[model samples]
Structure formats: structure tokens, C-alpha cells
Target: MMGVVLVAGALQHARVHAQAAGFPDFTTIVEKAEPAVVNIRTTAKVSARSGPQGQDPYEMFRHFFGPDFQPPGGRQGPQQNPRNNKPRAEPEERSVPRGVGSGFFISEDGYLLTNHHVVEGATDIFVTLTDSREFKAKVIGSDKRTDVALLKVEAKGMAFLPIGSAKLLKKGQWVMAIGSPFGLESTVTSGIVSALGRETGDYLPFIQTDVAVNPGNSGGPLLNLKGEVVGINAQIVSRSGGFMGISLAIPIEEAMSVVDQLRASGSVVRGRIGVQIGEVSKDVAQAIGLPKAEGALVGGVEPDAPADKAGVLPGDVITKFGDKPITRWSDLPRLVGETKPGTTSTLEVWRKGKPLTLKVTVAELKADKTAAVEPTPPKVVETVTTVLGMEIVPVKEDVQKKLRIKGGVQVTAVQAPASTAGVAEGDIILAVNDTDITSPTQFVKVVAGLDQARPVGLMVRTGEQTRWVAVRTEK
Candidate 1:
């Protein structure tokens, strides 16, 4: 009985140990990480807004950002200037404090990182250190697409945080943030890494955390327990413009890649392959004989583009670009954007239940080439075939020549599963599964052979866009 009591006590002690491990002590991390974080203040010359009776017009703005808030572009003029009693030439320009934000040093030689929006449109930038040292900062470069900007100050021997890879981060891991929320310098907030690789931006994936990041927290360092910088707090999801549990950080790895380019050319250039893509649906996957719903669905391919020159078609699914697997449609742009322009890369394309290898030369990302398809021919073929709960007719000869199509059936009416699959009246059906629909009689014959047990692939053309739609005739 004495032995049993001892064992019970041992189990109780082990439980207590496990519970204590769950709550981490952040004092050590705060002490080591706080020195590297800095408060950023900006000023700009802009037209000011004032009331008729010299009353303050931006009292609400001052309430949030303190009395130092300087509105970037205030109402220039309608009020007459006191000097001339007429609208002042080019409006009255006054230098006032623009905004307040936070940033952190990444090197001892005074290289720092912050959000592009933080320093955007600021005529002057000031960096303040924890030791009360202040210096004028120069904007090295800023990329609006990724929301990353690099700034440099004249200093050496500065305390900086070690950069860590955000790719190594996992959900539910302990993380901390040190920033000036509401201009409160060196404020510390702790939370877990809520998620990773969140697709909030087109070119960069964000690291979402539950850290209490607020207005002034933008461009601050998000540190791991090792006091390493994993991400830069850039945005928050809140209705009241305050912290509401969801904050987004730009991953340090991607930011460093941008920094490398910014340090070189003061700008960023990305590569592109001209293909408009969409997510592959489960029904479409099964209909196309794919094992699972993955890869990017090619909905439209621009004429004479890289993908078109590589034989990428509208219905083909791009499984891989070079050696990188396209886990989703968003991954393709990032991979392609990272590749050098004019460099040839291998492409793995899935078409009609078979895989094909092709090569494509990437081009510089420029203006979008995904223009809308030309208008359909108003005239419809006289011959009509009614089948599959809809009326089908051949495409007009003039329409075929204009659209450069060999043959397709125009959808005159749609009902039931045909409409259920997003097929509408006036849409054009170009194929049934793998067979191209050329004539009404051919379309009728192809519709008769459908398995009916599973979803069927329908190549549909809407407006100028063409894509594959999955339709199940049987319930």
C-alpha cells in the first residue's frame, strides 16, 4: 500500500511537469529581442485640411495615432488663403509628421526592413533605437507587390536580430512580437504561430499569427523563441482597425530574396508564363481520370505566349513547372516568377489521361495578356439536335472562322445536370470527354456513349473564355 502511494505521487509530479511545459516563459526572449526592434516615424509635405474657424479637422485621426498624425493627402483647397483671399497656388504645402510604424535592424551596419506601406509617400524617415539614438534613414528600395521595403541608416555596431527561415515554422509553435503598437516603443506580445503559407498576396505567401499586432506594429519583427526573426508583421485582420487575433507577417526568406534584388538594382523583376489558371475541382478531377484534385487547371492560354508555344492547351492541367510540383494554382506564379527570364524550363502537363513533357522559355512578367475571347457569331446553324436535357446546334460557319474553331456545338437551351454543371444557354460545347464535337450528329453520337455512372467532362466556351466543366447526367 505504501508502494502504491509513492507511484501515485510520482504520476502527479509528472503531470505537473507536462502542464508547466505548455506555458513558456518569454522573459528571456523579450530581453534578447527587444533591443533590435526600432520605432519608425515619417514626415511628408502635403496640402493641409483645416476648418473655417481654425478648428481641427483631423481630431479623429489624432485620437488614434496621437497628435503627431499627419494626413498624407488632405483636402488641398476650396478655402481661400488668408494672405490672398484666393485659393493658394498649388495649395498650401506644410511639412508635418506623416505616420508612425515599427521596424528592426537586420545587420550591424544599419540595414533594416519594414512594410512598403509604412514608409510609402514619406518625404522624410527617422529611425529611433532603444538607446535613444536617432538617425535619418534612406529608402534603399521598396516593392509594393510584396509589401517589403529596405531602409538603411548610417550606423555600425548596432544590435540586430538573427534571421530565421519561416519555412521551418510550424503551426502551434511559440512565437513572439516586439513592436510599437500605437507608438508604444518596444512593446512585447506573445502568441503561437497560427498558420503558415497563407495565400493572402499573389506573389508572396504570408505567415499568419495570433500576436497582438496593431497599427504601429506594421513592419516590426516577429521573433521565434531563439530570438531569431522569422517574419515581419505587416498586416492585421480587424474590423475596428485594432488587433483581433489575426495578424499576417511577411516571411523573412522571401523578404531576403527581395532585399537581395533591392540591394542590387533598387527594383524587383519577375518571370511569367502566360496561362490563366484555376483550381481543379474534385468532380473535374474524377472526370479527367486524375487520382486526386491537384495541380493547376489551364482555363485559358494566350496566343503566341510561352505556354501556348509549349503546346499548353485550355483543358490541360499543369502538374509541375520545372522540378517544382504545383500543389495549387497560386504556387505556379511564385515558381515561375522566381525563374530567370529567357531560361528554358521543363513542364509536366496532363492531357486526356496521359502525361506529356514539354519545354517552355519563361518571359518577363508584364502587362496581362489574358484578354477576353472575341464575341460569338450571332448566327446559329439551322440544324438542331435535342439531347441530354438541352437543345444543341452546330456553330455557324462565320462564327467558326472568326473564333478559329474547327467544329463545336452551340448550347441553345440547358436544364438539369447540364445547367447544374454551370452550362448555360448560348454557351458553346467543344468536346465530350476526349472527343471533339464537330457536328450535331457527331455530338448526338458522343452523348449516347457516356458512361452515366460517373461525372463527364464537357469542354465549354463562355464569352471569349474556354474551360472544362464536369457534368453528371445521372443522379
Candidate 2:
């Protein structure tokens, strides 16, 4: 009887040890980090009588159509009642919940960090801690480009998470998130770092994780195994407006940089070199005598801009920005944007089958728009020209002078093909299929000669941005 009891005790002990070895306990980390996590709620005043029917536009369509009806490209359509033309009665004004998100305290004196989108345009901001303490928060500063905002509350002696280095984060390492997902306060989820340096946004290279981050998890803390904050839970790639096993967090290093700027100033100032760039295609790389398909291929250069002044031409492929390599096209934007304005930086580019370095003085990125200049025209001229559902006119001398451009064609009207291709009025046509459009006649002629079966690429300058648009020819 004693031997049998001893064997049973040993078996039970072995089972307990095996369970401990298989599943690591996370209760200690959660208990330590939950106090710093916060739930944020915002209120905004929205116009009760908006749109043609004097009813909530989104509600009218959604409620009437059973909530599944969506227009092309997910844009809301006109909410007009065919049978009833009279305006529906609605309240004059009301305050509604604008958004719900999560944040974390960064200092003991009540300084916190959250996503800028969480409190953007909110009339009232309220923050609640894990200990049931609530306070109204003041928005110190927010940077929309980085999607980071610094906030301050009136409370004191708050719990804060220690900052960890995101640069040293590796894949397949354990990580956890603490947030109020779906209004569930202090929800803790654990997962491994799926990947790092994910390019999902224009400015940030996000830290990708498998943590179950949901809608209300935005602006929360992504903690390491040591209870240190590694990143800020920002965005998740989902189709159903819920977590789909892929979540992205803004790296702590990038967030701290923005936080420092916000603490010092009300806005962020980033450097820019006036040039439109795209990824170097494999075919283009081979054609241009490149060793491999890499770097940012300059598509267009703004006149009198930093890149233009530094002799950075359109055909130059930027291989390196300063000491950092441009392995992908997205790397150039992040590197250049992080630099300060008026700072001179060296750019190493591949040009004409050789590597060349150019020194460029960075310019402060502003809200101003850059106009397109006329390129050198083709030698041959074709007689038969079609407008392709568009009416255009050559840029006048005064307009060209105001736009700071030599010459280009301006769009006056748009029809089916042009409208379907997103060609709106007030757009300027710079080039068509590698041929520079010097006049409206040349644009029409180029469109007429384009192959109807293949797509036609047009370099369009719309307001402040320039990009290539592929328009399908009319059947």
C-alpha cells in the first residue's frame, strides 16, 4: 500500500511539471503591465440634419438597405428618397461617442501616448485607468503622419511601462498586448513576433505580430516578456473590421521620436527632396544595366527643388540615402522623412551603369503643391487624334507662370472613359507613354495612336501629387 501511494504521488508530480514546462505563465507580466494600460473614450458633436434628406446619411442607407448595400469602392452614394422628396425630421444636435481606443501611461506625472486617430477632432476626451480612476485628458500634440499623439492628464503617481528597444526585437519571440479590445478593459493576449519592419503605412515600418488585436486595441502597449513596452498597437489588416490574426504595432523607437517632437512643438517637420519615385521593376533594372532589381527609381523631378538642384535626374536610381541602404522603394521615404530640414545629406545613386554620389540639401516638407513642366516632345506628329472622353486646353502663359512650369495641358472636362479612369478636371497632363505632352493637340494625338487592347499609361499631375495612371482605352 505504501509503494502504490508513492508511485501515484510521483506520477502526479511529473504531470504538474510537464504542464508547467509546456505553457509559460503570463500572470505576472499581465499583473505588472495592466496598471499602465488605459481605456480612452472620445465624444464629438455631429450635425443631426446632414445631407439632402436632413437625416443621418449613413443610417438612412444602412437601415433602409439592411446594412449590406455598399457602392463602388466602398464609397457612400447619394441618399435620395425616390418616393418622398420632403426632408425627414431630426434633432438639432447631439453628442455621440466618437471613438473608443486604448492608451498607456508613459510617466508618473500623467503623461501618456496614444494614436492620433483616437482623439482627432474630439470635443471631449476621457481616459480611465485599470484602478478605476478616470480623468479628462488634454491633447498635447499629435502627428497625423506618424499616427502618434501625446496626452496629459491631471492625475499623479501613475503606473508606467518601461520602454524596450524594438530594434533588437526578433521574429518568433514571445510578446504580449494589454488593451481594452472591444471595450473589454485590461484584456491580455499573448503571441509571438510574426515579423518586423513591415511596410504597411507610408511613414512607419510597423512591427507585425500575431497577437489578437481588435478594434479597441488601438494605441495600447505591446509588451515584451520582461513587462517592457516594445511597440504601440496601431493598425490591423482585416477585411471584416476585426482581428484576422495579423496585427501591426508602431515601433517604440519611432513613437518616442514623434513623442519628443510633440513635446517640444505642436507639429512635426520632416525633410523632403522633390522627386516622384517608384520601385525599380525587374525588367527596368535589366534594361538599365542594373545588377539586381532594387532601389527607388526616380520617375519625375520637380523644377528648382532639392533633388533638381542637387542634379538628381529622373533616371537615377537611389541606392542609398546617407549611410542607410535603400533595399526597398519604401525605405527612401522613411529615411528622408526622418531627417531634419536644412540638413545636407548624401545620396548614392546608380546612373548609366555606374554608381554616383550627390550631395543634396534637404527642404522642409510643406503643404504647397508642385506643378508639372512640359517635357521634350516627340519628333513625329500623327494627324488622326481622339479626345478619349476628355476636353483639354494648353496651359496659358500666365497660368504656367503662376504654376512655375514651362508648359503642360490642363483638363477642362471629363467623360466616361476619363471619369472611370479617375481623371478629374483641373488635372495637368505631363506625359503619355514615355512621350512628353507639350500641347493639348499632342495629348489627343498620343491617345488616338495608343493600342486600344493594351492599357495606356499617363503621367498626371493633380494638385500637390504626381503619379502614373493606367487608363483602359474605350471598346
Candidate 3:
């Protein structure tokens, strides 16, 4: 009888636990959010570059058909098509279907949002509503960096979704996604937030979820339990070219920012500080006396740019830009890009075991492409001295002046610990640990005094990039 009582008690506890883990009912959320969602179809004009009679025009239209297929009219000169008067050789540009995606209206005036790739290169865009009403849409603008586009339709009284904050999202919170996955319009999928602020690129940190997103779901709305749109479904991680339980969304806040800019100027302008940044490793942090591995390590600084003028340098770690703390290397770019140009912002950098603050005037980004590496080193050698298994020599005066360095020793040869640490020939050693080496003789003395048991930090510059390499003195 006691065993039977215990079994009943265990089953009771299990039932209570199940009750606490309440499963969500998504039918209500779908009913409210589905009307705002839209199905997007695009068409592009592609040239059907076959011959006049669809024959192979091999070798400039002479090698095929025994060289008798002369012109568009055979025995006569070039003639126009009877139906359209367009040259027969010039194959008529056809409006072929390009792709299908999803979107959502943001306002009642018919301004909608979708992915930039959806309408990219598209000649015609059409948006279909839940009521089966379709209207032609004109792209207001598109920003490829954020992959967001703004489109406008002639319709009025369209249903729009209320925007929500992704910052307030937490893990395990129920979220819903409405998109046209695989051309299935108004399809609804539900899942909990897998993660937030997931860094997948240098520009935007994505909101990662397990929602069922596929190719046709590129630009749909991701909503919270409040029936507010939180994100735009943008990407997925899969091997079979389909959903694999991982979908990424562009946070609605970020997408709206791009939309505002696109609506105002038909383009998005971003700020540039003119520095190439990289990750700060733990070893580098320890060697530089940083308390923790955080912030962006400056690898290269463009001359005469904002960062250069603000006294930023290679090997310095940027801890903060204005009021925003740079927690990772990729965080800096997004923060800088978001800042308005011509505004003076506060900058904080870690230099030589201390934090230095400076004011920088943010400049408008001229181009989106990365700057090429500069400063081609001159081949000149003088008084080679061997230290740390590296043959070092003073850089020539003209080369130093051209490179704009006050003093540094050029490494001509390397082996063992130095080689293992990635120091290479033609590399310029600018500093040993915390001290700048003024000459080849001084560099040799600095290396001789380094603790053999501990790895020493050497600031080495290769081409336009600078980094700290840690090498133990003993083999």
C-alpha cells in the first residue's frame, strides 16, 4: 500500500512540472500578424542570346548553318519583328520571373520592408496581400550592407505591424515568424528565442532563432508574444539548402534605422574612422597588461583619416567609442557606422598599460570597400646584429622618413622562437615589450634583458599592418 501511495505522489509531481512549462498557443498571434505580412514577387529582364532562328551563333554567326544565315532577314538587310518592330537579332527582353520572398507593411500609407537581395536587379516588383489584392511596388532604396530595402505601393489602408524591441528579448521566450516559405504565403512558424545579439558579421549582430525560415522567407516579420514585430527574418544555416532549425533575423530596430535613411535620401550613409581592427587575444591582453580580453585591436591606421588624426595607432586596443563599450572587435564597426558624420565623439583607447581618451570627428564613409595596404618597405640594410635568433638592422634614414616612423629595427633573418612566433624577414620591430627600440644596438640590449622563462611581447610591423607577437626567449 505504501509503494502504491509513493507512485501516485511521483505522478502528481510530474503533472505539476508539466503545468509549469506551459506550451504556447500561437493561433491568436497568427491571426493578428498574418494580415500585415505580404508575399513579394520579382521579375528581371534577361537576354535570350540565341541566334535569329534559335540556332547556335558559333564563331560570330558564320561557323553555323554553312555561313548562309546572313542577317535578320536572310537575303535582305536587318529587319524588325512583325509583332514588336524590335531587331530580330536583338532578342526581345522578356520579363522572366526572378524570385519570390516575403515582406511586411510598416505603415498604413503602404510603405513596406523587405530584404535588399529580394528586389536587387529586379525590373518589376509585386506585393500580394492576404485579401488577394496585388499592387506594383517601387523600390525607394536598398542598403546592401544591412540587407534591408524600403518599398512603396500605391495602395492605402494596409495593415501594418507594431514594432517591438529586440533588446528586451530573452532566451526561451516564445516568438513567432510569418513568412512565405518556399512560395507558401502567410505561413506561420513558432519557436523560442535561441539567442540574441549573435555576431555573424562585422556590421550587424543577428537575432538567432529556430523558426522555420527557408529561401522564400527572406524578408518576413519575426514577432513576439505582444503581437509586435521584433525582427526581419533574413538568413538561415543549413547544408541541404533548406531550414535546419537555425534562422537569423535582422532586428527591427536596426532595419528601421536603415529604412529612415533610405526614405530621406534614397541611400544610407555611414561613418568611417579609418582603421582596420582585429580580435584581442588573451595572450595579447596579458602581455599588454589588459585586465581582460576585450575591445578591438587596431591592426592598421590610414594616414590623414579620422582615426589617424585622433592619435589612434596600430597595436592600440579601442575599448569604447563615445558612450558605447566595444565588447568585441566587430562591435566597433557597427557603432562607428551608426554615428552621424561630422559629429565629434569621444574615443577611449588602451595604450601601454594605460587608457587614453581622445576626441574624433567622424567622417562619412566614401566607399564600402576596404582600403588597400600601404607603405612599401625599401630594401636597405646596415650593421646586422643577431638577437633572439633574429638578425636585426636599423632601417635606412630615407626609408624611415618615407614610412613615417621615428625609429625601428628591420628584421632580416629569424629562427626558432622568433620564427615560431611568426616574426618574418623584412618585418620592422618597432618596440620590445613596452619600450620603443631607438636603434639596432638598443634593440639588441632590450632583447638580452627579457625574461627567458616568460614570453616577451614584440611590436612588429609587416607592410601596413602592425601586431604584437609573443615569443619565449628559450627554445
The candidate with the higher TM-score, 2 or 3, is: 3
Worst 10 residues of 1 by lDDT: 51-60
* Cα lDDT of model 3 by residue, 1-475, tens digit: 9999999999878777765888666777888888999999887775654323332222122211124334333443223356664545656666666667899999999999998877887889999999999999999999988889999999888899999999899998889989886579999998989998888663687999998877678889999998998999888776543467988899898899888889998899999999988878776777677778899989888999999999998888999999999988888988899889998998999988899999999999888656565544346546678888888888877767866787998888889778988888888888877788789899878777767766777888887788888777755
Two-way lDDT contest, 1 vs 3, winner:
3
The lDDT-based order of candidates, best leading, equals 3, 1, 2
Give one digit per residue, the lDDT tens place, for model 1 in 345-456: 9999888887889999999987545466554434554767787766888887777786667799888877878888888888888887778888889988887887988888
How many steric clashes between backbone atoms does each model show?
1, 0, 0
CA-RMSD of model 1:
7.5
Best by lDDT: 3
- Report lDDT (Cα) of residue 244, candidate 3: 78
Where model 3 places Cα greater than 4 Å from the true spot, the runs are 1-21, 50-88, 373-391, 413-422, 447-455, 471-475
- TM-scores for the candidates: 0.83, 0.69, 0.81
lDDT of 2: 0.77
Off by over 4 Å in 2: 1-23, 47-94, 368-475
TM-score of 1: 0.83
User: Candidate 1 at residue 437, lDDT?
Assistant: 83
In candidate 2, the residue pairs with backbone N, CA or C atoms under 3 Å apart (3 or more residues apart, or in different chains) clash, namely none
